[model samples]
Target: MARYNHPEWHPLFAGYASGPTPLTTGSYGQLLYVTEFDGAPKIISEYFPEILEPAPPMLWSHAQGAEINGIGNPNEVRALTAPTFGEHLDDWNEIKISSS
Candidate 1:
């Protein structure tokens, strides 16, 4: 049996309840499989956090833009409270993709 691996995915199980940590002072992209926001399941969305020093972090800045497949760009919020999301809060798992 061959083991398949998916690189380019740094899975973090920080459900919508506690929510993920905000990038205090940096810019990066994140892809989340959020099962929160409205009681629906498996809501995939992308986030780009751009925060610089000196300026205080703002929720609106964190949710500047998101691209959710199937559901055209929906309004984004800094956080979402969902009971379902609280059920699964796992640790970080880093798996890099490689060309075999």
Candidate 2:
């Protein structure tokens, strides 16, 4: 039930936890992705009713860039393409960050 305040995507920066859901069933962050191409971010994760906030209209996030930075993703510059296993992820921004 911990929350990390991501500077770039505050408020909408979904939480990542042991499982999929965040703190509880109703207090979880949704898997969201963003690319600067069209300036329109896309919801990569399946629609979760318990999601904290519905993806906002015209909402832009640096999630993609964050992932690219964290993982050394080669496809960081492109929206449609993701590096390797990233293609399988529901949320391109979803990363297994080390709990350091």
Per-model TM-score versus the true fold: 0.21, 0.19
Which candidate has the top score in lDDT? Answer: 2
Q: Could you tell me the TM-score of candidate 1?
A: 0.21
Residue pairs with clashing backbones, model 2? none
How accurate locally is residue 90 in candidate 1, as Cα lDDT from 0 to 100?
14
Off by over 4 Å in 2: 1-25, 44-100
Which residue runs does candidate 1 get wrong by more than 4 Å? 1-33, 36-40, 53-56, 59-100
lDDT of 2 by residue, 52-71 (tens): 33332212234332441222
Q: What would the per-residue lDDT of candidate 1 be over residues 1-100, giving only the tens digit for each residue?
A: 0111212212212222233455321222333444334554443443433323221221112342333333222223232332121112111111111112
Residue 38 Cα positional deviation in candidate 2, in Å, after optimal superposition: 2.6
